[model samples]
Target: MSLTEILSNFHISETTEEIYKNTIKASEIETPIGKLIAVADDNFLYILIKLKSPDKVINTFNILQKELSSSIVIGSTKIITQLENELTEYFSGKLKSFTIPMRCLGTDFRQQSWNQLKKIAYGETMSYGELAVKLGRNVNHARAVGSAAGANPIIILVPCHRLTAQNGHLGGFSCGIDVKTWLLQHESKFKNK
Candidate 1:
């Protein structure tokens, strides 16, 4: 068979096996609340979601693998090790901010919104409307800000849980409302320390 014919018969799996060989290291990290599955490489820490169930794990991997055009394997890297240490300090309230590099993947609007999330102080909270104005949008854009916050993948490091409703209700979290509550309370306890 000619090379053209051979290339035509190539399957995605076969292509994936040969060409997209970038290795993304992942690890299941334990936290006081639950397990967190973190994906990272030498340069950037990608997704660090609170572990849910078996199905969710597979689904998360599938989505990220396709986007990165790389294989996610069970292992550790310098970044993951750093993240583990930082998380430990954070949970104990010793660390107020994260210095670990993160690569956020999303639309331009979402990127802008998530960046704003990083500026929220450890114990302080911002309302969706306040965030929208910071993004140069009117109060009506609050819902859009909320959506971008919900899509944040780096969890506590990104600090989306620090956002609250105008009436003092905690907004949504990709993890869970309970997890969000815990994170907020935890930060409040250590804010002055």
Candidate 2:
């Protein structure tokens, strides 16, 4: 699928943004939840997604290879290795924050929203309305923020799962509601460990 198709699958429109180009390395890392395809360069981690939609996501690597003006190779980078270690520690309930350098390749709004997402403390969650307010927008923008959250490419590292619906519902996660629920539960169980 093309980037537009991927964004549409997330129920959001596409906005072009400038991103650095390079040979983006790719690898599949296993987690307690599932398998994740991590892509990055020497400078920054670009995209990371669980293989929920393997065909679409795998094709994304190809699409990104073109869009990024780079080649996608089946290997890993230093950033990817660091991310894998962090993820292992995260699932083990020993890591509360991520230290990996993440690059957001999206619109200004989406980037801002993702930055706000990165602020959500590990094991903590908030409503979309709260996140909107943090972004200096009113509750009305909650839906927009939610859409941006849904389109978050980095998944757990970006912490999009921390945003809930207005009524505290586990509304949606690109990885599946089950994965979202499991993440929240895992965090809750080990937050103070």
lDDT for each candidate structure: 0.83, 0.81
Off by over 4 Å in 1: 1-12, 53-60
* Per-model TM values vs. the true structure: 0.88, 0.85
Overlapping backbone residue pairs in candidate 2 total: 0
Weakest lDDT window of 10 consecutive positions for candidate 2: 11-20
Task: For candidate 1, write residues 53-75 as lDDT tens digits.
Answer: 44555555666677888776678
TM-score of 1: 0.88
Scored by lDDT, the top model is 1
- The superposed Cα distance between candidate 1 and the true structure at residue 76, in angstroms, equals 0.6
Error of model 2, residue 8, in angstroms: 23
lDDT of 1 at 30: 88
Kindly list the per-residue Cα lDDT of model 2 for residues 12-40, writing each as its tens digit. Answer: 11222223345677778889988887889
